[model samples]
Target: MLHRLFILLIAIVGLAACSGGNNFSSGGATDVARSYTLADFSFAAPADLTVSESENYYPFADVVWRGDPRGARVPQIAAMFETAARRSATGLTGDVPVAVQVRLVRFHGVTDRTRYSVGGNYHIVFDMTVRDARTGTVLEPARRVTANLDAPGGSRAVALEQGGQTQKVRVVNFLTEVLLAELS
Candidate 1:
């Protein structure tokens, strides 16, 4: 009976959230969106990332971005964010345009050992602030958001890589959907 009650409560919450035409659940990023759509938003890349210093810096780094065809630079991530932002703004017919200033705090990719032994999540941590797109006025204060993605390991990882679902692809697609949800 308790289980049924819990499930019913969850269903009610889901309905309430979706009633606003926004779902807080997706691939990895959860509740990163608001209820209403904005006029527009753009992704602005960080000038430089603060990477990990330790040799095994696989985990403790803010700017540990990798697996980008265009280069492991933070700009690529910004570009991906831009693409996703554009996708998210498709329904933005309002008058308040905004820019998402992203400062990558950490982008932890799975190490080879972890990738082969067991899969993990790409820990993407960043600080985001919304500003007026036309002017430089700040609209929203900075907030830290984590948008993680599962990193498949071993043969499964290989298969995904071959299918063109590289980390870059997956991340980009995930961000797009996340932004869509966030702005919707």
Candidate 2:
């Protein structure tokens, strides 16, 4: 009976460990050009920015442990950025003549096979550029932003999808901060 109880305890612990937990951390901004406050950085009011998905950007291309297909990658990523941008714009008071361009660089997450073999948290990285639309001058040079995120789930596909969802939120937050920071 003691041996059976021990086995049960071990199983419970194992399951708990396997269950997802957040190990997220913002990787701090890198390759930044210079810092500018809202007062220093001036642009037109009613800010409008454009988000473009690079040719090689593939957030959901490969399938590690396929369940249901994730469908198109570009549209999904574009939509995510668009949605986030709109939310971020709401915080701004006036219009800005800056055009925001983004390219998703890396999106690494766990798969069914790697989840156990490799112990690394999921992460997303992207490059952003804030430019003056009228002058065509680079306000904020291209900089890479990386953030570690919580794992989505246990199953491979579900995890990937969930990871993407979390990534979208991170991207949105990052962009919003950038916009608000420049204004401040």
Candidate 3:
């Protein structure tokens, strides 16, 4: 009876956390994307990502790890970079209201980990490019972006863990914003 009760409790909790939708939609960077689409330029990502999980360690946004059990993954940062590049091309066209296309020229993921004074963590690097959709000209060229995922060094969850996810997401947002600013 105890085992059954435990299973039931876990089921209820998991159901509460599950997302209602299967599709993920990330808005383009407004700063760069005043106008644009994916057909314009080419892109390349980093190599591959391998993420470990911990109850206390979390991402800033509703990011989806390579194999997230929760199924609440957000669009990867590479997509955001490409979107921003498309928007930049739109900006270059003087917001002429033409539909631009972006192509994925390359996509790779590079994983690296580091040990800070506080903890050990990993980051995924993504490299890509964006260009003119119709004319096939390079828009932003190829650039690399990195997203860090940190794991607490200690054994148990600390009070700081409460905001870890929010902070990580904020860092990602800042990175995207900066990239868009530079590309556009």
- Please give each candidate's TM-score: 0.63, 0.46, 0.36
Residue range 8-116, candidate 1, lDDT tens digits = 5764453233222212232323444433344455455455556532323134445544565334456666777777776667755555666666666666655555455
Provide the RMSD of all predictions against the true structure, rounded to 1 decimal: 11.4, 11.7, 13.7
Q: In lDDT terms, which candidate is top?
A: 1
> For candidate 3, lDDT tens digit of each residue in 30-149?
345433343344334323433233232232322234322343223354455455554454445343223333232222111111111233333334444555556666554545444343
Residue 118 alpha-carbon offset, candidate 2, angstroms = 11
Highest-TM-score candidate: 1
Question: Model 3 segments beyond 4 Å from truth?
Answer: 1-118, 146-161, 164-168
Ranking by TM-score: 1, 2, 3
Candidate 1: the clashing residue pairs are: 33-182, 62-105
Regions of model 1 farther than 4 Å from truth: 1-48, 52-57, 69-72, 91-95, 134-137
User: Order of candidates by lDDT, top first?
Assistant: 1, 2, 3
Model 3 has a clash total of 29
